[model samples]
Target: MSTDNTLPIEHLRWDAASARGPRELNADATAAVTDPGAGRWAFAVADGVGDNPAAAAAARTAADAAVGAATSDPRGAIMVAREALADAPDTGDCVLVVAVGGAGDRCEIAWVGDCRAYLWAEGTLRQVTEDHTLAAYFRARNLPVAPGMEHVVTTSVRTAAAELIGTADVPLPAGRLLLCSDGVHKTLPTARLRTILERAADPGGAVTDLVDTAHRLGGQDNATALVVDRTAEHTANSSAA
Candidate 1:
């Protein structure tokens, strides 16, 4: 890791973990890349839609491309990932959430399908991105979220237009940024997740605990977690005082 003298936060750290669960193969991919000297970071989580033949490959392709481009252009990153996955051989489609963090308490998020981003700060947790699924669409329209409809993705990296790509700039509170696939979120409730995050000592521990908890609770799909934490650097005098 490098250092950024101008970043008000002074220090940043990130960690990630993934598990295949009881599935035949792990089709989830996660990545965290940081330009520490530049005070920039990129985070991504991708879940290969299960029906796809080459689900794992598609997930990796999207995750790698998104993380590579997110530092400079988040939306462009998703577009590049989409175009790359389009050339995949019979891989079907995948849902993704990509985030870019800059100098201060602000980050930009781009997503398609049901992958999600959440912010946990000051002992409170809140979801920052909405799911792009049939169930979510119905819920938005005041219609019933039919059984078995939650898994039906409305748009994905392989399908959504550039304009259809969802993007948001969120203010980071004094805690952690979490990105995860449905495998983890679906199996664990929000209250349980908040408790796990709050008790973990560091980003690495938080991710590990989250993934493990997902499996222990019966994860039916590949699970992945990525966490980013930023803190202000304190001088010796300040520390002692």
Candidate 2:
């Protein structure tokens, strides 16, 4: 999708863990940019896989590379990130999600693993990405799943090299878009998430409530979230009229 109209946007990012009890720092990083010239805005989140010093670094590397590439060429962002990962010392897995907003209410997203993006419009919530997890596969296969067993993921950023990329595109209306890590999904059900997004005073409040809800539910993993709200940008010619 592509848009010709400019729009106002907002973003936020947070990390609230150090990898369990003694990990010292969370192994995740995120970055975003708004490019009016290109009529697009890009945002990405990268999660380091495994318990290693380089995990966080790898995540940062992925986020930085993805965002940098998006700035120049949204289509090339994933390729740039993949190349960066190839050159970096193999540490573990990392998942990436990149969202690009464009003129005419167009939005595109690319992702790997379970990191997710959601769009809310007209009182409805829609998830835009598929989770590449073992559990998801099982469910797709019509297997019976027990409660509390859903966390046993089979695919993640740490997955084998062959399964590290996923992508999607959608038209974004004048509403809210949510980009988040697994922690938010793990704690807050989709119903609750929708409610929060619907009632949130602003993008910042939505992100805060998301993280807080995860912590309240005994946040076992690092929690992070970003919220973007869209508003039409008035051009000089349009405004003058």
- Residues 1-241, model 2: lDDT tens digits: 2121224332222222212322456776777766665655677777676557677777878888787777544446766777787788665557777787555456778777777889888889999888767677778989976754455545444343433556667867657778877777777889989998899877777878887777777777777777777643322223344
Indicate which candidate wins on TM-score: 1
Which residue runs does candidate 1 get wrong by more than 4 Å? 1-10, 51-53, 234-241
Candidate 1 yields a Cα-based lDDT of 0.83
lDDT for residue 228 in candidate 1, whole number 0-100: 78
Candidate with best lDDT:
1
Clashing residue pairs in candidate 2, if any?
3-103, 3-104, 4-103, 4-104, 93-157, 93-158, 94-157, 134-154
What's the alpha carbon RMSD for model 2?
5.2
Each prediction's RMSD over C-alphas, in Å, is 4.0, 5.2
Model 1, range 1-241, lDDT digits (tens) per residue?
Answer: 3222223343567788999887888888986677866768788999998834488888899998888888977788999899889877667678899999766668899999999999998888989999999999999999988868989999988988999888999877458889999988989999989998889988889999999999999878788998877664422222444
